[model samples]
Target: MTLKSPISIYDAQGLAFGILMASLGVTFLKAAALVTGQTAGAAVLLSYLLPLDFGVFFVLISLPFFWLSWVRRSASFTLRTITAVVGISVVSPLLGAFIRFETLPPFLAAILAGACSGVGLIALFRHGASAGGLGILALIVEERTGFRTGWFQMCFDAVIFALALLVLPLDGVLYSCIGAMVLNAIIGWNFRVAQAMPAQQVG
Candidate 1:
């Protein structure tokens, strides 16, 4: 699509598919007892500590970032992000019911989860939306500083992994690192911040 083109029904379908793939990645991580990074990681960590589902924590934690998104991006972008966040929050939980991984290896789960999430994020970026949380920050930083969004997220993932250590097994955290690397590498190498979307209606 050209920079001048408007968002169409096809774009909506793409956004929906992106959300589904991202939610599937989350399901993989949850099944393997591994948390990658970003708001999804925080939601998973919180879900482990509390008595709620990942969906509840995912939406609740992402709420504050909406304001940040509004200030940094556009209203449309912010709305798209909110919708995407809610969509993942709703879909991810239901996935456990339908698609259960009886004995998923954490190492394998990490690779699959990272691949799914990376491609899914590319789709969202193309549509001028994100999964909320640090994703918004990553985009803003990239736009302003010419920094790669994936690298920016990798820095944040460091802190999340450190915290994960306290809550998760050492081996699990190590495997999670592999997933985070794969996720960031895909984004850093593929999605350039400047050409992420069109200036017109990508958001």
Candidate 2:
């Protein structure tokens, strides 16, 4: 996930951290110069290559998906997603001014990014909201086309990583994959928890 300033060239960590935070993921991929999957990943990758701020790119890339979400999903879903996206674009940049990482390794940063994102995303889900991106499209495809969501995500990740190779070092790509894996694992495990536990127990 990432957050950055539009007025400055800013740091890549903000872009990476921002993309994650917008989706409720924490920011660490940027510290390791890593990228991710989905719309956030694409935005992060673009921020690395372009002069635009991460938030600006995040909003631009999300516009089409927001339209799809409005057409395919409920209006409520789209509204909440818009709120979350705007919140991320605004709030994430402030995190850096408050919290600073003194020293973080690529492996550790990846892990933290996943863990924080997983937890944050769960909270968003509980509130009936989403960050929206490829995720919205993935869900639409899965429901309407009978495609598996997992497979869809995997394919997207594969593409993101492939492109990441051109921009990031091999180790950076590898670490980013690890972060993505951790995020998925946390999501999977928690979904099971959400399903199996009573609503009270889930809390």
**TM-score of every candidate relative to the true structure:** 0.94, 0.76
Tens-digit lDDT track for model 1 on 1-203? 22323557977987998899899989899899899899889999999899999999999999999998876677778888988999999999899779976588899999999999999998898887899999998888888788999999999999999999999999999999999999999999999967767574233
Deviating ranges (above 4 Å) for candidate 1: 1-7, 201-203
- Supply the global lDDT for candidate 2: 0.64
Model 2 worst lDDT window (10 residues): 1-10
Q: After superposition, how far is residue 106 of candidate 1 from its true place, in Å?
A: 1.1
Candidate 2 lDDT, tens digit per residue, 1-203?
A: 11112312232233334345544343466555677787778888888899975667778889998888777665655665676676666565566446667888989888877777656554444443456787677655655665644456667788889989999999989988888777666655554323322232110
Which candidate number maximizes TM-score? Answer: 1
- Tell me the TM-score of model 2: 0.76
